[model samples]
Target: MTRSLHSTDRLPASARAGHWNAVIAEAYFPLDLTFRDAARFEGQLEHSNVGDISLSRLCTEAVQYERHRHHISSATEEQYLITIPRKSPVDFRQLGREVRCDPGGFILERGDEPYRFSYANANDLCVLKIAKPVLATKLRNPDRYCALVFNGREGIGSLFTTMAQQIQRHASSDPNSDAVLSRHLVELLALALDRTSEVEQGAGSSVRDAHRRRAENVILRDLSNPDLSPEIIADAVGISKRYLHELFAEVNCTVSQFVREERLKAARDLLQMPNPGQMSDIAYRFGFSDQAQFSRLFKAKFGQTPSGYRAQITAACND
Candidate 1:
């Protein structure tokens, strides 16, 4: 069930700092907080768990938040949060990267990393907290996206922002529907990130990274094509087969290995869905020739059979 946590007027201003700090800490993570108006601190947070992700709407006056190394070391789970401001901009600094994220742009943050995120005035924030494993399924290396701002005002980004707003507006109508909506939001986020990553890769100074990203994107879009191969991918990405091999070698993997891992991760994500269909269908969707081969490779990578893994996660979600 969804819930709201707010600081009330019943408590005098002098006593609200601890309460507000505790509330924010539990809702997101433990952070050193200094309110712009500590004596008159005002904040309200509404949050819920959407499948394996956490969705929250945080409205608060000006404040400075610092996630110190101590807090980062004490954290038990690794998560990534997408923070979208409503009116003001947030100055987020992490891992030698300092980013100023304004409205219509979202910041991707890592829970395991120490960072400072502060806004000057009162601000409304939309945050989606996703577990590392959940996000890793949609990304090759999730850490690379941290502390970066992706455009949320056009195309897939626009759709993703619109979906988050809708979910925030109607998350509690029905528990079942909320779960499904949450899943959709996550899917949209993955698409937005996937697209943004490709663009950034292409724009970077390294032509090798750009070619690799192009090739990877092609492989992702055509995962279901059994005829997919290094030659097809190289041609589609406008690179020679030898050059493609060299590029992937930089990542210490071959084209076939990359394809296999992407398919397996995709299949793993599909398996965790509330309505994951027949195992054979899932396998075929990821371009596996047959269910038997898919099951063998899946077990080899994840150390469990597909059915067994799904049953385990299903039971865990229910619990």
Candidate 2:
């Protein structure tokens, strides 16, 4: 569905501020909107939903939006916003980090967290709001990417931004196609985040970060090898076995647990596909020793057995 709201619509200038507040709250979530000049402040919001994800283009005067603790307390599910500024820069503070993203760059904001987002000048912005689970299926720890600016001018970032704009401009009327586009958008975003070097900054040290990334790459490459253990991963990355364990520990995850989770995520992705092949073959393909173990682990991670998850996807598609 597609709809738009503008502050100028039939309301007196004196009432625009209060009306604007409601307009924005309906577009996104409830927030405190402080307009530089409330009576004269102007804004326009165009919004559409493609599948479960929402795309909105906001054009507004200088304003600040604050998501307070009370707002978060009322949220049903965690969400993330990827904002791309077009005319001016935006200042965002969340999760103890503050950042200013200019045109040609984008920043992420965690919706379930208290945050302050503002721009000093009028700005045209494209924002994508997606539920946490939708993105988590493609990227691990989506929260860590918040408050970081990503290049929207090149490579995967370029593709993602371009596609978002296109989708907002020509949102499909067909729900099935919209669902496919939504998945593609998420996949592109996952690739963009995966390829970014800034993601490793969480490790706290350059050398350790590089080592951790290298180790993760090796693990991803050898995920199909049932014997792919920490020792093998460490040896391949030219790091000591003990050091490899230490690196993973810093992230509060053990090497084995990380491997298992990645495998489960991979299996889940396959299950979502139209033709995921046989259950036993899918299990063994991801290095699971047997179907029973795969089912147990998949259920533990995703709260559903592999077959059940597949059936759920199939049912949704049929509907």
Candidate 3:
């Protein structure tokens, strides 16, 4: 499933950097680059797209790169490049946050935001270029993870880093297996980041985490109830209504927002099934009071109505 996007070995030494830049833009998003050593610059980029997620590895010389206002506006897809560098450190700046991640650590770089990501030396980087919404489904408000470094060598991070390394080494996995593995990778990455964020939040971490999980479980179980609300979910999970609202607040989200997002994600997945059932039934089952409301929200969130998404994704898979 691996596609060799670019290699210096194919081109004459003269155009290595130029050709490399073009290949990178084609596979990943476009970005402005200032080569540290233009004349000597050479790099390699190979990628495989599993589902909508990209597993890419780039070996390159030092370069100062920026995804600025122009690039952000021109981009088609919103993504977060979860980087795991094997050879050198990456200095990334985003949302007024600057962080350095050495080998055995990783950072999130947003494509929708202006940011700087650079390696001061040659690097062999393993990056999972994931769609923003795909990652968001696993972790709430993923933007807050940007520009922060997490130790890839610890706890769940250890498993995540190891899996990425193994996947790169064996890039010949079939599409179906690769897609499943990629989803697991995202889940693990989200868990590691959530755990890290919790630890940093000090004493309140455990309570917040407990409440959040319980509340989410209630939401999932009662998604078909159009009347489901923060109050209902709170009572179901045995927490005060105000406390439930505050718990979601700590994650910079509202309970209703979380519920809506989960519903949309659920609808999207059901649509992709072999037989997704009647559209109206699917909508009602996910707590949408009306089919039209479901259609509008689906289109707004996923850029396509439920039926359109099903048809388009199905066709793509067949191809």
Candidate 4:
């Protein structure tokens, strides 16, 4: 379904700010809007839901939007915004880092944090509001991509930007199709971000980052192998075992821990399928030695056992 809000509609000038504030909050989240001229402010927004993601196109006059700590206190879930400016540059500051995203670039903003985003000129923007957990499944440490400008004019970034516009232009009315489209968009986004040189550009040397990326790919590919370990990954990537361990340590996790977490995430994805299969089979497929251990670890990480999680999803779908 599609919905829209216009500031110029029959609403009174004095009521425009309050009404627009409510519309912005309802479409995205609570935000403090400071219009260059509140009484003469002009803006328009159209929003639609794509599965668990919210997509919106906003056009507005000069304005500054602020998400303060108090506004975050009322948020029921943690969300991130991927903003793409179409007509002018956008200035965003978050996590002590600031960036200016040009028309051919995009930036990620953390909704749970305090940030100031503004544009001095009239601007048109494409914004995606997605929950953190939903994005985490596709990319590890999604927050690392925040507050950085990404090229949307070439490479995978261009593909992602094109897809987003296409989805907005031809949004499916069928809920199931919309859900699938949302998943594809997020997967593409993860690929675009992961392939970028900026992914770990600030972490260390480019050579070390390249090796780490290779190691991660090896782990993801051979996740079904019960013996997947630091030694095996190191050998597969032509790096020493100690070097592999050191690489992972730079990210504050051991190789074994990364493997286990990936397995759990894969298993959870399976459980969400229409036919997830028997618990034992699902666990074994992910290289879990036994269903009991899988259950314990899954619960510890996701706050629910496999069966419980599936049941909850089932109940929600039914409703």
Off by over 4 Å in 4: 203-319
lDDT pick, better of 1 and 3: 1
Lowest summed lDDT over 10 consecutive residues: which window, candidate 2?
Answer: 198-207
Candidate 2 C-alpha lDDT tens digits along 5-54: 45556678889988888878787888998988987888888889898799
**TM-score versus the correct structure, for each prediction:** 0.62, 0.64, 0.61, 0.63
Question: Which of 1 and 2 is the better model by TM-score?
Answer: 2
Error of 3 at 170 (Å): 0.7
Full-model lDDT for every candidate: 0.82, 0.85, 0.81, 0.85
Clashing residue pairs, backbone N/CA/C < 3 A, model 4 = none
lDDT of 3 by residue, 177-264 (tens): 8778888888888898887665433423554577688899989888889999886896677645645777798889999999999999
Total backbone clashes of candidate 1, pairs 3 or more residues apart or in separate chains? 0
Q: Could you tell which candidate, 2 or 3, scores higher by TM-score?
A: 2
**Per-residue lDDT of candidate 1, residues 48-116 (tens digit):** 776667778888889999887678667788878899998899999865567799999997887776688
Number of clashes recorded per candidate: 0, 0, 0, 0
Model 1: lDDT equals: 0.82
Off by over 4 Å in 2: 199-319
Per-residue alpha-carbon lDDT of candidate 4 for residues 1-319, written as tens digits (9 for 90 to 100) = 4545455567779988998899898888999999999888878887888887888889899999999867876778889999989999999986556788999888888887678999999999988889999999999877667777888999889988888877876767788898888999999888888875744447324556787899999999988999887878977886556557877887899999999999999999988889899999988999999999999999999999999999998998899
